[model samples]
Every structure is written in C-alpha cells, then in structure tokens.
Target chain A: MLPEALDAYVAAAREVGNPSSLHASGRHARRVVEEARERVAAALGCRPSEVVFTGGGTESDNLAVKGIFWARKSTSLSRTGVVVSAVEHHAVLEAADWLGKHEGAQVTTLPVNAAGKVDPARLGAVLEAYGEEIGVVSVQWANNEVGTVQPIAELAALANRYGVPFHTDAVQAAGQVPVDFAASGVAALTVTGHKLGGPIGVGALLLGRDVAATPLLHGGGHERDVRSGTVDTPGVAAFAVAVEITIKTQQEYAARVAALRDDLVKRVLSVVPDALYNGDPVDRLPGNAHFSFPGCEGDALLMLLDANGVGSSTGSACSAGIAQPSHVLLAMGADDDRARSSLRFTLGHTSTAADVDALIDALPAAVERSRRATAWKTPR
Target chain B: MSGGVDSAVAAARAHEAGHDVTGVHLALARNPQTFRTGARGCCTLEDSRDARRAADVIGIPFYVWDMADQFHDSVVDDFVAEYAAGRTPNPCLRCNEKIKFTAVLDRAVALGFDAVVTGHHARLGADGRLRRSVDNGKDQSYVLAVLTRAQLDRAVFPLGDSTKAQVREEAAVRGLAVADKPDSHDICFIADGDTKGFLAKRLGATPGDVVDARTGERVGTHEGAYAYTVGQRKGLDLRVPAADGRPRYVLSITPKTNTVTVGPREDLLVDEVTASKAIWHGAATPIECDVQLRAHGEVVPAVVTVEGGTLRARLLTPARGVAAGQAIVAYQRDAAGGDAVLGSATITAAARTSVAPEAARA
Candidate 1:
C-alpha cells in the first residue's frame, strides 16, 4: 500500500509545473493539481473549488479555525469569541487558546458526554445564549485517541442557524467514515493525508465558496491566498490517490478493521478481566481500540507488545517518548490511575487479522510480567 | 514495576510470593513541558516509558498514576517550606512518606490489592519488622524511616535481601528493558542537580550578612541564610580568614535574625540534639540505639530519652555538625546480618557545647 502511494508521488515529482503559473509548463502543473483536487472533492462529496491545499492537518486546522474566527470578528465587534468542543485536537483547541491569551479572543469550550461526544442540543443552547459573541463553532469529526465519532451534521446545522461558521477537523475520520462535506453543512472541514495512508506533510482545508478565511502565512499567493506557500505537488498527488482509493474501499475496509478491533477487545478483556474499555464501544472508529487495565501501565503494555513484534500507541504520539498520561483521558474524567493505565491500538491499511492474533498471543504473558516487575500491590 | 532492575525484580518476587501482581508507573509530572528535552528520572516521561517496558517484559498489568497535584502539594511544597525555614530537606524522604507509601498504597488498597510493594533497599524482618538491607553499602533505611506503622503494614520491599548487582543480573535473566538502567540520584524535581538554584527560584533571595562568631564582625555578604546549610564552606566568600588559614564553615543559620554564622569545624560539632515528631516503628516506648543523623553518615551510639512528645538524644561519642531538620534514625542489631530500625525523629534543636578544658580530657 505504501509502495503504491510512493509510486504516484514519484511520478508527480518528476513533472515541473506551478499550478498558479500561466505558462505551458505551469498549465500542465495546474492540470495535475486540478485533477487531484477533483478526485479529493469527488471522494468527500464537495465541489472541487472547495478543496484548499495546506501544509498538513495542523496547518489546515489553523487556517480553518483562526481564518474563520478573524473573518467573522472583522465583520462585527460582537462576534469576538470562538466556541469549540472540549475534546478538539490541539491544532484547533490550542489555536483558540492562543487567540484568547494573546489576541483578545474569548473562547467557550462545549462539554462532551461520557463517550467523548458533544450533544447538539447543548451546543444549540450555548449558541442561542452567546451566538452573537461566537464567531466560529469548531468540533472534531472524530477523536484521535478514543476514536469517538461526533455528530458533526447536527452541530453544523445548529451553527448554521446562528450564522456562525462551523468547522470540523475530519483528519481522523476522513477515510474511516463517510465524510460528505456538503451534507454536513460545515463552513470549513479539515482532512490530512497520512491518516488515510497518503504521504505526510500534505492535507487540505475544504472551504465553502461563501466562507471567508484570512491567510495565515503571507508570501506567494497560493491556495487562493487563504494559505500562502509553495504547493507540494507530489504530496498532493499522492494524497489525492490515497483518498480516492480509501473512499472506494472504505466500506469493506471498515468491516474488516472493525472485526479485528472487536476481536482484540474480546481477547484482551478475556485475558485481563478487569480491563476498562475507553470511548464509545459502538460509535467509535472502526479500527481503534483503547483499554485501561487497572493494574498495568500503558507504557509497560506498549513496550511489552513492542518486544514481541507488535506495535501500538499510548496517548498522543506527539509526546511519543514520554511516560506522561494523556490529557485527553484526563479531560474525559479518568482518574490519574485509570488514565495512566490505558493503551491505544490503532489499525491502518496494512493491519491484518494475523497482527491481531499476534497481539493476543503475546498479551497474557506480557501483562503478567509487567505486573510482576512493577510489584504493584493494591490493598485488599 | 519494570523500569529499573530493582523494581523489576521486586515485582517478580511479589508474583513468586503467589499474590496477584500488577505493575504501576506513576506519572507525577504535571506537564511534559517541564521535563528536560532529553533526561532520565523517576516521574519523567522517559523513565515512565522504561518502567512500562519493564512491566511488559514481566507480563504484568501496567499503569501510570497521575500524581502531579499530589506531588506538588506534598514533595515540592514541603521541600520549599523546609528550605524557607533555614533547613536542608530530603525530598525523597517526603515522597516516600507521602506519595509512594501513603497515596499509592491507599489507592492500591481501594483497588483490592493486598499490599503496595517497591524496590527500596530496606528489609522487613520475619516478624514483619523494618530493618536495614543485607547490603550495608546500599542500605536505604534512613529515607524510609519516616514510614508509619500503618504504611509499613501494607508495604513490601522486595529488593531488601538482594544486592544491586544481583538485581541487575535478575533483570537481564528476565529480559527486562531497564536491566542496565542507571540509578537516578539528585532531587527528581531539580533536573539539573541545582538544589540551591531550585530553592532560589522558588524562594527569592533575601540579602543577609555572614558574621564571624569569635570576632563578632561581618566577614562576608550572603544572599540568604536559608541558602546556606549547616556545614557548607566553599560558597561563602569571606574576606576574613581563620587564624589557622582554614576555610570557615557555616555553623548556624538564623532565619529569624536573617544572619549566617560561620566558624571553625569544631564549632559545628554538638554532643546533644533534641528531636520532635518522633515516630517509633513497632514499639510504643522510646529505646536506646545507634542513630544515623544523615543518609550517609556513620551510625553513632546515642541514648534516646523521650519526654512528652519530644526526644532528647545524647551522643555517647562526639558527633560533628548535627543540623536541625535532619532525620535521626534509631537502629538495633538484628540476628539477620543487619540492624533493625526502631524509629526516627526530626532534629528540632542542637544543644550548644560550652568548652571545658578538663572535661575534654575526661
């Protein structure tokens, strides 16, 4: 799968053309970019013009959030605040926080349910009360850690009612679920390449024609001037191919990945009886499983699995090498012990049933060893 | 359970003892931003990962406990307060007494565990008595002396009988990731080994005068008395030198007066010290035993007499520079190759010695 994406990337890299240039070579480059854009739009069910290229997921999120917020606030002094869900990715949440701290922007973070999903009704009430103050309402399409899929359509509908621009970070949900940008009624949507088996360092911010966005990076007038930078032609081409393939095979892939995830959950729980499964069981992502074993540490489990040739994730990969507990878990109301005891196993295009089997086979012994090494004795 | 060889072995021993064991690595750091970009220490992200790896090798359930707030309140706050009061404090002692044995143990009990175990190099006798470990050079009884009876009852120290080398060998044998993990020293919170700097950062320096006891003259200017400990010598830039051309040692720190007193080495020695907040491990009454005033100091012979809530201990031999706020751990010889800890007390005061020419001969 990786080879295929690389092949497309290599072919695109050989061509020399600037999508924005008017020369013959530039026109050729423009064709390649346009073709990729059309493919991505077709997959996401949005107009080709709506797809705006950015550096990556983080940049895309920044552009969508800060862009819309500034644009709305510029129109009216009353629209000076940004409302976002509590569990948003740092790209959205931290940007809002930075704006609040440095740019005099007020931010109201809506709460999430036990499953890490936000309620549209609660959001609507918040909008009714502070709608004039709210410039933009942002919620993630899905949570990266727990894999909880939020009700984006309902949230967008409510935001639309208040004439507030709604943005969703669909970075994790783009290929895993059916994300129709038009049907969702969101002003802006974020999707990244790497999450969908595409090349890294490339993603897009889908902006509706009516949506107004202020450019973050100022340079050459690329990405319709909403995001100014040299276009990553190869990365964009690979991403387009990956998105097209992912969308075509999404249903079958979801079925297979969900089966493996469920199997893993069953096997892990069976071996470690007191394991606490995190996130929404049914409404979660198809290929993600998060569990907290009462006595085991997440890092210990991850290492144990790694030793046996199985790879997994714990908390955010950004803070990869650290032994710190996940803020996401903490924000979801997990106590210190529970938050520390958790591990996340995410499946991708290359994951298979055998991989799940290997994990199950190595689990019991690893858990036993980890428990012994820690000598963690809880009082009866 | 798994990070270091000792903890790994301790977990193995507990499991061998037939108890349902689980490994836990506490995440005491509040934010990853506070961690040194690349450093190793307990509660640091790297150490936690190493610990987790060890737990996995041992096949135990592993967890990270978020004790950031608790750590700040207990260890960090206590350390700052101890320094502010013109005393040197051991943060490891406070962490063991508060977080590890108490908070972690309480949570373990609530989770239906039989006991909380650690790799502390201290022993529990057959009669369930707390004693020094077999390896005298590696004995860690002083830091653990602050544990109460209730805490000791639910605690297990598995590395008590084993040497550091043996623990490493066992970790290698078990294929633990932290088999060769370096032993972490220095204050965990002060990642750069700058205790004085840490104190200064926490407590702003209050300018004070360093005075000579004999001449009654201001010899040097110091940032604060609290910054200087009882025996520190090199950092004091004194303009006046001793008659013998020896460096002046910090004899006393008076936070109330905001003055630091410097004198000869002999002036720092004291024959008697009074300790408050005495904790007797097993016995209800105070007993005479050898006491170690510092973590690495010699165990000098002393007679402990309790009156009300305070303990007055008179050293049979002259001990040097016994500072207030140091722990005086009492130890009695046991049949099992080492001494058993009787109790401990925090030194509240050191009695001034009046020089007597004839009495020194006696």
Candidate 2:
C-alpha cells in the first residue's frame, strides 16, 4: 500500500516538465506542483505562495542561510553577521562557519543550557549587541539526536525585536511537534521529507512573502525565483501526503510514542540504575531516548543489542564510523568519556509497543555484557 | 577474541569448561589507518565481528567494546609523553596493565562473572601462582607481570598449558573463523609500522643533531632525537665517516640537550637498570628471578631489590641497550614446573659507566 503511493510518485516522476514554463505540459506540471504546495502549506498553516521546494533539508538550509545573508548584506554591507544556537545541525553551523571563514561574515554561536535548549534572553542580548550587523539568526526547532525542543516562537519574537530575519530547521520537529508556520512569524523555515515518512529527495523552505532570498540553484526561474530547478512532482506530491497524514495524526501519535519512550526509560533505568539520560526529561521529543551508561561503551552496547536482534544507534548515525566522542554532548559540557558512552534510541511512525517491549527485555543482559566487556577505572 | 589461534582456542576451552562464555573484542582504533591491516591487533571492528561469529559457532554471545577514549588516554597519550621525555614507551605493556587486566577485569567481577578469560600464553600454577605458559616460544609472562593478585583471582588464561601449534590445531578442529588470523606485531596504533611518523605527529617535528659523544662533532641530522631509540643505527642522515668507518648507533637520547649521543655498537650495553611502579601478581614483596627486558629478549639472571616504591635490579650478566620506560619483568621458576611472575617496573634510569671504554662494553 505504501509502495502504491510511491507508484503514483513513480508515474509522476517519469514526466519531466519545468513548472516555470508557460507551455501546456508545463502548465499541467505547474498545477501538480502548486497543488502539492497548497496541500503542504494548508497542513502547516501557511499560504501556498510561501512554500518553496528545494533538494532536501541541507539545500533548504543552505538556500535559507546564504540567500538571507546575501539579501540582507546587499542592502547594507554592515549587516554581515549571523547568530545561531550552538546545538544546530551541521548544515546551518557549517554554512555559517563558511561565511565566517571566507565571506567576511562574523558568526556568533549562542550557548545552550544543559538541556540543550538556547536561552531566549541570551539571544536577545546577542541581537542587541550586533542587531544592526546581524544578517540571519537560526536555531533548530528540535535537536536531531538529543530531542531537545527549542522555544522557536520565543526565539522568533526576540529576533523580530531586532528586525533580524530568523530561520528554523524544523526538519526533526515538523511532524513530531506543533509547528504552525503562520503563528511562528519566522522569516524562513526548513523541513525535510524523510523524517516524516515522505520521499527522501523532497523538502521545502517555508518563506514569508515579504522575506527576500537569493537563489541557490540558478537556471529557469522557479518557486518565486528563490530556488530554481525542474520540480520533482512525484516526490513533492508524496511529501505533501506524508506531511498531511503526519500532522493530522500527530497528537495521538505523540501521546502513544511518548508513553512508549517513557516506558523504555523506566525499564532501562530499573535495570541499569546509574544510567544518565541525556537531554531534557520532559520537554524532549516523543520518541527519542538518549542515555549514558557510565562504564559501558555505547558502541559496545549497540553491538550487543544488535547481537540480540535489536538495532539502535550510538548517538548520531551520520557520524557512525568516527569513534570519537559526540561533538553535541561535548558542547553540552559532557566529558570525553561520558560522551563516548552515550547512545541514542529514536522511534518513528513504525515503532510499536511490542518493539519497545522487545528492547526492554533484551536490554538488561546486553548492558551487563557490554559493561563487563569494556570497564572503566570507576566502579559505576 | 578471534584474532589469533590462541584466543580462538581459549574461547573454546572456556566454553568446554561449562561456563557460559562470551567473546568480546575491543574497538580502540580511531580511524581505518589505526586498524591492523593484516590481522596484527585484537581491537579492530572487523576483528570484533570475527570474534562474534566464532562465538556464534560455539553457541555463545559476542560483542565489541568501544574503548577508543580510554585507549587514547591510557595508551596513546602516555606513549607520546614517554617518548617526548626521551624514554622508549611500551604501549602493549600500558594497555595490558590498564585496559585488559584492570578495566575489563573490574567490569567482569561487577557483572557477577567469576572470571575474565583471555588467550595470553601464560599460566596460573597449582598453588594459584602466575606462571609462564607451557609454550616457551609464546610465553607472555613479561606483559602479564603487571596484573595484581586481585585481578588474577578472577582471571583465566585458557591457552596457558597449550603450544601455539596445538592452539591452531584445536581451532581448526572446532572450525573457528580466525583460526588462521596472523599474530599482530608492531605497536597496534602504528598501522604501517611508522613509529617515527606517529611520534612526529604527537610531538611536533623538532629537528636535532646526532653527534659523536667523544668528538663533539655532528655525525648526522635527525628529525628529532625522540624519534630515535637507544639502539637504532640506520636512517641517520650522517655525512662524515668515522675513523673506523663503522655505522654509529644511537647510544643515548638527551631531550634536555636536544641531542642524540651516537657511538659504536658496543656502547649500547648496560649492566644495571632501575625500575619503579612494581606490581606483584601473587607475592607482596620482591624475590630473586630471571628478568626479561624486551619482549623477545633473552632472560638474564638478576638479583632484584626493592625499597620505598623503587626497584633496582643488577644483572648477573651484562644486558644490552636497556632503555628507560621499558618494562623489566621478573620471572621465577615454580616448584611444579613453569616460571612465575614476581613483578615488573618501568625503568627510570640506567647507570652510565664513568670509564668511557668500560661504558662502551658494559
């Protein structure tokens, strides 16, 4: 049934038409693209004109950052500064770093608390210091690995006071949290397809009509000339469907997943009493549980769990091969050893109570084995 | 667990003993370059998976322990610092003393396990004394000397009584995955066996000179004196030929002088060496034993003495090029046959002879 929905995607994928072209087939493709934009915008509480399709979350982030920066700086070269939260995904952080490193733009990364959420007051202070020079300010809607939900509304309001354009990578938050684009009042926002059961190659940047953004990909002008390329009609349609399904079922989904996540935490802590939960206890993502077992190595525990027919990531799956301690945990003031000993368990729409139960059943022995295999100097 | 034939047989023997046994491989490599390309180290991820498969065939569980951080701090960093201070560090010794015996053993005890087992070719005598493995060619008593009594109480070496050939035959009979896995040599961290490159990366490239001690003339320019050890002779960029035209050996590394003292090969021998940080496996005090300096070096008779945390051993026969920071492991012959570990220490300094000629042949 899921593949059938993707079959419709495949049929639409075969036809190539520039949505910006004014010809008959182009108009038909344009209508399909517009319909997808409308469906997605309605689901997220935004207008159809506000939706601009991009390659994926990464390209969306790059376009939003570089575009916003260029637009702001073109108006006033003095406005060449960007402020971002320290816990942002590498897309934003790396892009900002590139600007700072080569583009003569000064980037200030705001520090986060132990819970991995940036203080709005700190953002306000930073804005006050360099408000006139600030080109763009970004903070993630929800942390990808730790599941810390940032107060995006509060951050947006603070940015508004300084007249600095704010952008949020709502990639991890789109279906998991309450993301109302119209209510948030942010100049730009980023959302990807994969995290919410959409096609992998599709995503959109929600740009406020008044906001100015330079085009990242240039060819035939498309998506209000903000992002230029032939649109993936099938991908965009499937993404719209996924977003609509996710948003409609979010409340019930969140409740069920949160309960399951809570049960996992309770069972795990019951077995390993000294397990340290990383991220905010209550204000975290519904299906994300990050924990640190003091003497047990995370990779060791992960392998043990895999041996027991359960699979979980040792922190971020993106940095899978690098055995170094997580940069995110290190930024949160965790020691190198503790950072290396942490694991991340993320649940999606496919997760079930039975899955949680299986994990809980196998966790005790796995933790015991891993702890024995890689002991530390301390007893815990 | 599966890297060498010994560990493979050890896992089998432990299972045959009716204990619920599981094999664990520690992943300590930070990069692919740090991995043992030809099956030399026991800590690679691939080796861990192989161990897991071997355990599966034996109807037991297996796991890979991520010990990258601890290995970096305890072994790699310590090695760099030791060499920077003009001492030759043994990383395998540090790893055995810290990670395998100490950290892993402690965790095994806490997990309600009676013992942690390994394939190290060393034994425990009938009186529960640490002994040399029956396989004389594979005896690892020197490295095992740092294990404390409490650690040995929960330690089991299954290959202690077996020869290397017997271990391979046993593994082949049992059809284990890594029965043919080659023994790892060189420092595990130095994948390409480039100790110079490893040290240069750790301690920055500070160029120095290797000079003749008697002539005070520069014999060769070196990347750093720290890169050259006590007995190294080749790869010194020497331009001038000695009067005898013999190749010069690095007699000493003077980090304070930023100079490598070079002389003829005979100058490398030393009759006395002092070691500290002694750890006795079964006994509380020092005892007379044969001491082995290098891993494959010949055991020489020595009278061991200890006072206030310092241990000094005077060799009955003059030893060669005994470098500081290397382990001097004491081994005694047990009554039941096989040698027992007395203890070990890090050599802090060696006595230099006042007579230059005598020093050259000491």
Give every prediction's interface RMSD: 8.3, 5.4
Residue-level lDDT of model 1, residues B1-362, one tens digit each, is 52567888898788878887888876666785577444455666677777777777777767666667778888898889987888777788888988888778775664446799899999986677788888888889999999888888898998898888888888888887677878876677777778778888888879989999888889888886778888788889888777778778888888898899998777777778888888875554446678899888888887877666577888776677677888888888676557888888888888656553433553
lDDT of 1 by residue, A41-95 (tens): 9999899989999888999999988888888888887788888888899999999
Q: Per-model C-alpha lDDT, please?
A: 0.82, 0.81
> In model 2, which regions exceed 4 Å deviation?
A1-35, A47-49, A110-132, A145-163, A217-234, A259-284, A288-348, A352-375, A378-380, B1-87, B104-293, B296-362
User: Which pairs of residues have clashing backbones in candidate 2?
Assistant: B40-B184
Q: Which 10-residue window in model 1 chain A sums to the lowest lDDT?
A: A371-380
Query: RMSDs, each prediction?
Result: 8.1, 7.5
Measured by TM-score, how close is model 2 to the native structure?
0.67
Best by TM-score: 2
